[model samples]
Target: MTTVIFIHGTGVRGREYEETFKTIEKKIYAERPDVKIERCLWGDKLGTSLLASGASIPRYDETLALDEEEEEDKEILRWKQLYCDPLYELRLLLLKPGEERSDNPFAESPLDELRSRVDNFTPSDKLQAKLAEAGITEVFGEAREAVIRSNAYNEAWDNVSAESLGEYSNVISRAIAAQAMLICYQQEKYAPVLTNAKLRDQLVELLSLDLAEAELGLGDWALEQIARLALPIGTNYVVGKRGAVTNKISPMPCDILLYQARGGKIRDFIRETIAEAEPPVVLLAHSLGGIACVDLLVEQSLPKVAHLVTVGSQVPFLYEINALCSLEFGQPLPEHFPEWLNIYDLRDFLSYKGSQIFPKVRDELVNSKQPFPRSHSAYWEQDKTWEYIMEILPR
Candidate 1:
């Protein structure tokens, strides 16, 4: 059995994190009971807490509070301690090179002297008795554990949210499946070996072929739909009745449009993720994720990607440019590609019939025959897609 590593995409954190992980795990194991799975959590603990409180957690915050303070006076005090304190700056200094449990600057602060007073500051019995005239009462409880989790935290931490739950789930599953597939790709498990560079070229060529074949074979209704999605080639169109001719055909601009619609900040994210990760990895992009992958691949920024698989993606035809994908969020795709597969469904209206950019590796191109389900998400539930992906996975 192959081991699959799951990576969550934006707006997922806190208690919702536990539920999301559990749901994905259950789905995978239910399909292949013997498969071993693990997770790579990129989330921060403190960010989770601030989000739970409905406060914006900046990247600099590192601790999450379990209990909330709501009293007007207490809330102001909590804000000073939590947000404006020298404590946070001190923490940063402590985290600097070669310092984890060393002495803190707080020891030199006036707060340190105030803390010292606690040793000798208990009230005397006579004083307590005198104060009893006012009839003041105080209540205190021992500390107990409390859990804080929310999608807001996830958005704060993961930079994703609940509204696009379906899309995010699909993107995460593709990454997980790619990790599983990388196992086979490394081992050359399938009859035709597919490497990242080879697969990318092959897929681009296949997209060209498939688009050609689809255009040739489509019924009148299908052709009309394709025409609607395509930018008119070799023609001049008036821009906004200014009556000027433009050389290029512009499709509806789905990738950038979806990126904004999904509330995702796509630009720095993919490039930053690629810059940060270590080598020898697989990239699984779902829908807009495919656009991200194209950005990384085209730039040759992610040279270590062993394989890439895009599922239910509209990315293959996203560009009018021949090189990299021309989405607004990232730079164009490479003329050469990584080992990749564009998985799609005929019934799913969200995906293109065939992407236009993927080029062939050798004469041989790997296209698995499977029916991707109705929803953009149903690919995860299909045994054929999962099994085919596993067969190509690198060990």
Candidate 2:
């Protein structure tokens, strides 16, 4: 019997997360009654709680009351204590300066350390140049500027009645955080780096500082905002909470795959799931989950995934970051690589055609008639998604 293993992507947790898969399971069972299906729940295992609910907001009077000696150190110390060290290693990995191309054409330079990180896997000279240009300073500058210019926060506060201060603030905080992520992700150049946790933290840190300067507190509300923004990038939760906050933060679907690809806490879970499953196993992974499955096949040397399918995944873009654990540049597909099919919609910015990049894989482009993330997410709800999976399953 074939066991179809469904691995979910980021921003999913609790009963709601399970229900999403259960809906798919029902669909799968109806078509292939003999097939067994199970979901890999890795969110709680690898998830970190970065935000708290009840951090004290510094009053404007308090800011005014601070001694000159305390003022200079306060901002610096708050950022350093909260964010600097946590992002240090990641900054090192991503921000190393690139060397100029030499006249000799063969001489390596100091930047090779950065280049070697994804030597063969580098996407293109143009893309490499773009990656080389990436720096935390530029990221911070851009985010800070955007936050200062945006009227979204002010409007949110203005709309709040005195009686609804608490609830409105929470909503506004989430909106601002979401807006920050959206602004960052919408940038074509920066979108690829959004998966890099250190960079994401840097953006949030700078944005938080801007918010604080604009009178938002560095309290539980801000922490939660940063945490929520960091979710998509697969960063470990760095903020701590004091009072109870509503569990509105969901796991980013990409986090599970990104973290697992990096040898995260879910490694054993993946191994055990594959080992215990019945033979002729098929992997039906969505979004980043597909990338995780590919990583398993390449990095872990598991050759038993007979059939593999991906829906609305960013695997092609991941190839640009040198993050895809498998399929290095110019390398032939592994002899044991599973039969692969990738499905995506044109409207989904995150989804891309993978067959051209990974020649062995088949690509299916369907029109979702939705915009952006909705297109990325709408795959499961469509009948065509099921048809494609059923078409590939062993008869």
Candidate 3:
């Protein structure tokens, strides 16, 4: 009879968590009848929150950050459409007669020009984070080269750059996206991203932002005619959602930040919870919960905690990058860190592999047949995820 304690991920709370917990319990019992199901429901009490109302939202007094965020989202949304249909603006431009300037590739090719610009390019932290999630380590090295040299981008540039920088921005953004998608598509072992709208959108949005930011910095005419096609519709949508947008999803970041900055409380709660559980314990954690477990086990040894299973977890990636709270880069996990089983869905951006870091860990791939945001949470309901658990689970 083993004790399995569940430590949930970020932003999950109350009734929603209870439902998920019950479902998980039922699933576990259906497989292993003897094990006990316990949970460390820390989000409601120990988690981060804006108890001061919107006071902690950092300049929320003027709603400045929210407004800026709102604008970025709209811009990203606009870029998403451009990536989805790389030739969208070009097609629009062609619809109306534009002088095909004779100052074409022979004089100075777009690829040649783009290569020079992107040579000194560095992906923004946000874009780098997204590309990293896609398993693209360096955004500029091979991937960028491929995009610049590719026939797809060249043809689009030849046709569009003559029109305006606004339209040409589409070509550049789409090229980066094409290359990024190609990488993601290749990295994907289970299924193509084409059918996965959420995943595709994510890759597109990030790649678009990467190039869009670059262009903005270089002062490209990308902003020219940005409002030409759908000005009223996009404006209306942003104005309508600006008020309630941040309120709904802001606290989750507080939870994560507090944990990283001063997470002793969260770790203490887990330690206490472990002490209450029976002799042999398996800490089954998801998302942020997994990060906490890694920190907890690293700080002190819990022999009773036999195994640490992380689903849709970032334990390894954080450790590798030295972003993990307790452990630093190149530091080995404590000898008593337990036999780790990391279950990751390729489509889940939140999940990462630990085998490369810990060496002793087992990295299991479980495809939930879901995409992006959904893939992160889908592990709870995935059959393969459970199978991976049951393999070494104390029966």
Candidate 4:
């Protein structure tokens, strides 16, 4: 006899989380009725709270922010992305065919100038102070490496003419810097900075200060604003339905921060749930819950916890960035770690691959045919998700 424990992600609670849990249970029962199914619902008990009752959310009820504040906040979230992936934007650069090789073999390479400038460039004092205050540990060197190795950087290098090399200095350095102070504001530490709209821009502006001052403005920021002029209805949420949108997304980042800062309670909740369930166990977790389960399994061996299934999860990405609570970068998974199956959809940017990093693990693909944000939550609705789980359930 086997048991499958359902662990839900952040920002999910009460009725909706319960209904999805039921859906999963119903699917499992249809396939393997004898197998036990239980849930690990930790949001209500341990989720982050808005003690100020969302006093922090600016213009909470307003149809619009009545200012550039909303736009600036969106920009801040862009950099918070750099904290997770330094090359997040660099990778989006449109690749142009590199300059046709100069007929002269000895023409000095434009890339040489970039390397020299990168080596000589000094990080500003303000940037250093800000980095320290921002809880940005161990990023610049990695960011530099990531930028240098990026396809966009290489493409830019190849595309530059010796005459244009000077123009490209700030572009390349800023690329190395990525979004200039581009740490995504997803962290609780950045909460105060985000509240003050100027700070995020100051942070981004300070990022550019340390780079080339001649300022050719060589960088291409892919904000990629889709002009849906015809979709007047799309603006309704911002015009009059701010609360509906605000309330739904507000908890996501805060919950991630809460788990990172103090996730012991959440993990302990999982242990408590496990203690009540029969062995052997299948830890079926989604999103942040999968991350929690991975952390738990890596920290210690629970023999009864036999298999792990993570859907639309960031476990691999977190580990890669050394942000995971239990494992350090390059550290091997614990000898007692259970078999893992990571399920993902191509459209879900939040999801990542595990098989490449851990050869023994399996990765399952499901197409929700939905765009991101939506794709993230669509995993539970797919039949393939359950079919894959049934194949591995210990009979």
TM-score of each: 0.34, 0.49, 0.56, 0.56
lDDT of 3 by residue, 168-192 (tens): 5544655555455555435432222
The digit string of per-residue lDDT tens for model 1 on 1-395 reads 34444433333334434544554566656656655554433333211122244233223313223332232232123112322221221222222233133335555432233223222233345423422321111100000000012222122213222232222222222222222233432333321111122332233233222212222211122122222232222212132321111111111232344444542345345545654555445555555556556565665545656666666666555553332244442333454566766666554445653334445311112232221221344454444555555654555
Ranked by lDDT, top first: 4, 3, 2, 1
Candidate 2 lDDT, 1-395, residue by residue in tens:
88888876666555544755766787898889999987777666765343453244222211112212222223223232222123222222122233233334476432332223222221334433433333222343344344334454333333323333333333332333333344543442233223233333333443333222222332333333333232221112312221221133334633643474554455567767888888788888877677777777766666557888888787777776665656566665677788998988766667877887887788887764443344565566556778888999885
Candidate 1 lDDT at 236 equals: 22
Please give the CA lDDT of all the candidate structures. 0.36, 0.52, 0.66, 0.67
Please identify model 1 stretches exceeding 4 Å from their true place: 1-267, 274-279, 320-336, 353-356, 360-374
Runs in model 2 with CA error above 4 Å? 51-250, 253-262
What CA root-mean-square deviation does each model show from the true structure?
Answer: 27.5, 21.6, 15.1, 19.3
| Highest lDDT model number | 4
Prediction 1 TM-score vs. true: 0.34
Error of 2 at 216 (Å): 48
Cα lDDT of model 4 by residue, 1-395, tens digit: 89999999988876657767766787788878899988788998788767887676664333432222233233344443443454544444344335555534675454564555565655678877765543343455655665666676665555555554444554454455442234433222222232222333444455554553444544333333211110122354564655555665767888999999999989999988998999999999989999999988888789999899999989888888888889898998988999999999886778999987776679999976544455687676566787899888999
Candidate that beats the other on TM-score, 2 or 4, i.e. the better one: 4
Pairs of residues at least 3 apart in sequence or in different chains that clash in candidate 4: 79-182, 79-183, 79-184, 80-183, 80-184, 81-184
**Model 4 lDDT-worst window of ten:** 224-233
